[model samples]
Target chain A: MSHEIPIDDGYLDMDLLRFTTAGSVDDGKSTLIGRLLYDSKNTFEDQIEAVEATSKKRGDEHVNLALLTDGLRAEREQGITIDVAYRYFATPKRKFIIADTPGHIQYTRNMVTGASTANLAIILIDARTGVIEQTCRHAFIADLLRIRHVIVAVNKMDLVEHSEERFNEIVAQFKEFASRLNNIVDMTPIPISALHGDNVVDKSTNMDWYEGPTLLYHLENVYIGSDQNHVDARFPVQWVIRPHSDEHHDFRGYAGRVAGGVFKPGDDVIVQPSGFTTKIKAIEGFKGQESEAFAPLSCTITLEDEIDISRGDMISKPNNPPKKDQLIEAMICWFSEDSQLSPRSKYILRHTTNEVKAVVQEVRYKVNINTLHKIEDDKTFTLNEIGRVSIRTSAPLLFDSYRRNRTTGSFVLIDAQTNETVAAGMIV
Target chain B: MEEERHSYQVNHLAQLESEAIFILRETAAQFERPALLFSGGKDSIVMAHLARKAFHPAKLPFPLLHVDTGHNFPETMEYRDRYVAELKADLKVGLVQDSIDQGRVQEEKGPLASRNALQTVTLLDSIEEHQYDACLGGGRRDEEKARAKERFFSHRDDFGQWDPKKQRPELWNIFNGRKHHGENFRVFPLSNWTEMDVWQYIKAEEIPLPNLYFSHDREIVHRNGAMLATSDVVVPQPGEKVETRTVRFRTIGDMTCTGAVDSDASDLDSIIQEVATARQTERGTRSDDKRSETAMEDRKKEGYF
Candidate 1:
């Protein structure tokens, strides 16, 4: 219950950018993770020893850097990742948390989960197998997740002898196909050898004609500012703090992380649902008192007046409030094992701090991930299938586009009977 | 959009803190009787901090629950009491010793034996006795591969077992805290935080922590490739050498099982430096984790926090 922040020093350089690796069996996602961890000094002696021991036991030819992240026993035995393997490494410039997800078709859910939180999606394309269906599938999901930046890591330059022609061919095909999608912020194709440690965390010497930020540089300096919703001021109350049993009993503050925009203490704000107006009393964090808080920072705030604020409530500017409505048009990814999409299926819709009874009124279409096409005639939605659906909630959902605010614009559907999460939906 | 002396001078750090605070509030509102698990560790301490920030003027909605193994360090217990008392949050202690005495659990014999694995029994009994539907803990995915498989709002069956194969998919930040009768949910707001991320956030946020986290001089003994603290609960084995060593615990758990490394990280920066260069994982020092390949998974399945 102690509200005091830990007396640790130094701030995270916002230069830290999150990226995911996409590739199957031989495409080098694991190698890339291993290489990054190894090259970045993130690999400790014990970890190296563990990997070396595993490699020796397996009787592999060389020290498999990929074993650094193959973490699961099954994955180590099978030589493939089935679940997301999150790895962390930092440079002087920034910190990184790479959601190393499986590239196999069976683990599309894992990829979707990893991509959902990424600012940039790195699609690893084997130079030998250029423009494959899985390549298309990975790209499609990355785009769907609203990932602003895309980096096609054309891996295994060593296999192609670091050929420029092959890289160009893959690049042209990808660019031609991706040009059809209008939402791409920036797409840069880089050729590297994840196995030989080319252009991962450091610049590659094998490719002199190419000049680009080594994989680490791009990740360290990728433009993520535009990814955050700087224009929408949204604060979803996570907790309410009150030090009662004294004169402070009257104190009521809304504590939460700022999802988007800047929250200034004196700014006039409107409480969602109740639509009550108030001014921010204070925004308190470890850096001491501050005037404004932006997305992703956690802070405690005291309102100028006592309000009936609890979780799931939104506090925003009156003039630029999020759309509040019960009829939601969204892209829902089914997650339940037993439940299938059906009209009027009762479920609990969880968005931010709010929970409400909701029904899937319609399943417009399901997208074929491999082909990146919408199956309009499909009657039912299955697990890991991205689809468009219309939902009607018991209470209006205060929201923004999933493109704008990942926090306020996203909702999860839970099966009422078994209490299983049935779907993850992003508001359209 | 910059304003003068706005509410507590909002910044990115404040935003993250606020989000955690909001999630804490939701946990309070969405669950019938929730208890924040206080381990007196860094992560749980941060969890408690956010809980306070969530409801500043009002008392924390729920109480603090600790399933004490009696093998825990005296410092941790003192810090736990001081912290809870300072915030006036009700503290609930469920002792593993009591569970063993009541025959709910059995004690393992031998010098190398630990009561670490037995805490789960006391924890489950406490949950049933107190009727806690939602138990919030500071679990992060980057800590371990199995933990990475967990969802934000992890649903547990009546037996308190986690089916990794049957885990509910978590999308975006929307969490499903709903459960049927007798079922429970374990909520981890820090599921996304990594060890380095947690440390960085802790330092950046200036959160207060116990002195044990920083390097301090303590009576210790060398045993089984780890430094064991010289405590009343854990006696040195026949061949183990007892010595006073300057060490800091990366994690604090049952003293009988928790291990420490030789360190001079008397400050946060030094600790971060040590963590960055740590040869073994924080869990690697945990003797209970060294018991088996799926130790945490098995303990978690039995409703251990």
Candidate 2:
């Protein structure tokens, strides 16, 4: 079938929304994503052909949509997702990036990795099973990651004969558990049968009692405009662009993606940790000059006066500079199985564009993800465990609370010996 | 037209571009010696474009490394030369033939034999010879299943092996490029982009590509349901007949494995439209992936880009 490429304007105007899906093996998380892609016309015919062939070879009665997300050979053979697999799809309204993460108990670190940068999280719960411990664990992680939007998709409505009571019960149970957590501002609950194409793309006629929007409808319309920290005004210098050419001689610009807030031409800014103040002369984008630069927009900022600015430096409004501190407290998600986190252990801490040597000053407590309990007695953190810890860096880090600004407030700890990312940290 | 406001909203393409540029700059800053793996493919071209934009007035910090299999489309090589000369960037070629001649790798035998897999050895050898701390690839996760699991800052062992199960967790935008003396990192800036996204970006940015990407009459032969470009490297098997067909390459790999698709998409707009409705993936045409279900994964585990 021939398709027409619309004018570039349509492609240029679309916004991006990144969401994560967390569910146990049988919860149909893959099927939900597959349905979203299939119904949205994102899945190609050849992909369907491949999945169909695989499903038939595996002796499945129906075409298993889960095969779409289970892209790895082992995962496909085992019929389960083991790691975080990113899937892309687009509607006319917006583009989407789905971090389809495994929901097994041992894969908590995988869920965190997927949900960390997600603007929204979709927690799948089987209608027949109601809210299980896995459901609570998923919601807890979503909350811990401070995901602004959460959608509790009560799947398998077809198996439950489209029972509205089952959907309500699961929603109520999830809401009760979610209330105990923090920072999930918008929580939506919808009943869907991913396998039977009900309440996913189009409204399910089987569930007349349900009045909420379809999963696709909610996904397309969700307001993520205010998700970024537009008031903080933080820019972490990633690179210093200097072209030693005759035409553009003496051209020195600080290149970076705006971490937070808005930066306009002529704004008085401070360069940290040097604390040098300067004024922004112009903001250069890839195409040309931009009127203003906001969070996540990569641009080159030319200052009015030449100052010593380099990579790992932060540029912000002089009046509202990021917190410059050597000692910081943050919630840590230990990711490495090779090493455990303990007091006095030194690791390379990367925050924003800056990297510094950091030592664990204190292990405040270990968190029980399922129950959201803080075990104060436990002073050690192993793989897949979340804990609160205080770290002292060799140099000061410019930051804000992760709750205030996810970009600047997050950091990763890398083991020096192996260079493996051992843990993820969110500023408290 | 009214002046576009850059404050209230940022489009998806702009966002993706910004993220990619950020990653490119990060790689340049973190690594002492980094090289952009240029294959003269659409993805690589887009990557080169992004790299140029990342530094703008400044020249790219790293050179461009092309691991040549000695079996290439003439158009691709010419394009590569012109593109590098235009940017005034350093170009390094790691020849598979050189590796074969040096006894570092052996050439495969038979008609379906390709230097596609041998390039991995040449690539690793080149990395060692140049001491490149980081290799920027145009690999996108949406292209292949194994690639979907790759991190933006993927770590490789001293032996240049990728352990899929033991990958470091990549969270937020903080990438850990820290490694020991011998170990290097594989940085994929286009990890988030899809085939459609790449085409759309190319169209929007008006990025120049090899003419092979557009439709033209070429000598091709049908084999295993793919249109293989007729070349000295590809010896046709029994019962396979050559014919002239108007086609374009969806992907640009070694001429031995990369196939062409029958299309009339001679321009950027039409190509975008063709990609939008294409039934198969861009890699589907490549005979290399058709070798086995886990071919890409196996090759990736052994340090294939």
Candidate 3:
């Protein structure tokens, strides 16, 4: 299915990317967004006027860039961002979605929510202030969320006159600390002055001693093709679209976004759990049939010969079928306000498009993020804690390791009572 | 706007679009009765575009609801009619004049009177009359600070009140549309998009919009530092002078409420260029938002979209 094919629809030619930003209140996450919007010229006249009005109303000397993204009224009143304000800004290089997450400790759930779908996690650090505990906490969450790419932005370089010595010190310290992270890899460091527009879009001659892709350059050129799972073919059914409209009543195509791998119209595929084999029939989508389909593209597929496939059934090539098992081991970020991981606690686990009842079978060792070590004695996982655990589901889930494919490996724990999603887990 | 998609992990605009489409489908799948709020503005137009794409090759299952303040630019209504007819979607209009006639709401009696705020009452009455379970709106969080705290699936009580603290926690892609009798949900698919994104998307998609969005020669007068077009609703006073100038509206609402800005950006590219260097916020022209710091929040609490 993964073949070079020529087709038209030039605009949809773009691939999508989601990223999260984690930084302390002082690190200027909001300011960075404002700078990006302001420099990239994404902010509208009305919004800029509102920010200026609010800035004057608050009696601020300079235009408060942070005020631009701090959306909550209480947040603006308090002069701090409290919730995750997902911001979308596109450039010619790529369309970027910035999940501006809170750096405050109490808003850990918001951070986790932002981190869950991000392929890259940008950790902002105030250059004047070197590596701090807050930075460690954010980096830990990025790793825990399995974000393959990490950009450590040493912001506010203008404050220190773009000091190479200070930048090197922080970079060295960060690199050493990140190497200790068991889950983290692909660490990239860039010195930036978000306030002064240094290394954000244009390279700074002031930092000639440093040699690396500028912040914008890296964001524009980073290899994110491998971010998706193309090896493990897993499909979770969202909903079956029959249309049933005049033209096509016999269209019994299973519709869902491909969670991993590639599929074609005539490939040998296997339906999981049923142990059924069938030839591919048609790889259909909103734009109609195509020669190939890949991960994250929502489309419909009709099997060559009718087979038993329902909402939870996984689809993959015969050779690369994901392991189907009732017992699954995973690392999790607990996000509940009222619930904690306990033995025999039953919850609805929504993996991909499949929802099944899973119970906490055993309390696994909790890792100390600060020290990057496993705390075997501390076995209980509480809210906002990252830990290794095992779950036994009533039905088997076909999945790939989260490291291999985020969509296939990830699942959400929802409270059966309020129907509130409590935690996000990634299969280890 | 960024043309390249793979540079980042997810296309922000596409992610936002997909999320919007997902919400639209969920609205269609979950509610037996729903309506799309159409103000003929870019945001609402953007929502309509997404809705059309959500279930392409099929007509929009829901009707377009526009709360008329009885003080609207003639061009907006004309454009609204054309767009709906083109897409084959039903268009529903709730007139504030009827609400005033029925005494459901009393019009403000003063020089600076505006139906902008009063449209909420007629809107609520229409929703109740129609029993619409869900109302798809084009409100963006970046439009205002109060809106920033709003969830994509904002819940409203029977009386149409929005409580900041009472809002349900939005997690991942899961949106709770549950409500009791007389209660309805206001869906904002464009909540994450900024005004810039809307313009950029509109340009990229080549979506048709009202001529009011583009600059044209119009006679207008300055009042309270705002450029007000000389419509039937807006009359020039003894102190104010009306003059013809090239102006366009960034946001279109009640004629008494919407304000125009001086510009010559009649084409898509020029409009984007003007938006890129704009100095004032979009809502700066609307007198409604100036009522108070929490005006939008309070209005929203009252079931105002």
Report how closely model 1 matches the true complex, as a DockQ value.
Answer: 0.44
Per-residue lDDT for A249-353 in model 1, tens only? 566667776787778879899998889999998886533566666666666777897778877799999989999999999987776556687766888888887
lDDT of 1: 0.78
Query: What does candidate 1 score in Cα RMSD to the true structure?
Result: 3.3
Q: Model 1, range B174-220, lDDT digits (tens) per residue?
A: 66677788988888877666676677667776777889888888888
Tell me the TM-score of each prediction against the true structure.
Answer: 0.91, 0.96, 0.85
Model 2 alpha-carbon drift over 4 Å, by segment: A1-8, A286-288, B1-7, B235-238
Please tell me how candidate 2 rates in CAPRI terms. Answer: medium
Of candidate 1 chain A, the 10-residue stretch with the lowest lDDT total is A1-10
| lDDT by residue (tens digit), candidate 2, B40-102 | 999999999999989987788899999999898999999999999999899999999899999
DockQ per candidate: 0.44, 0.55, 0.26
The CA lDDT at A19 in model 2 is: 95
Give the B-chain TM-score of model 3.
0.95
1 or 3, greater by DockQ: 1
Mark the 10 consecutive residues where model 3 chain B has the least summed lDDT. Answer: B1-10
True contacts kept of each: 0.53, 0.73, 0.26
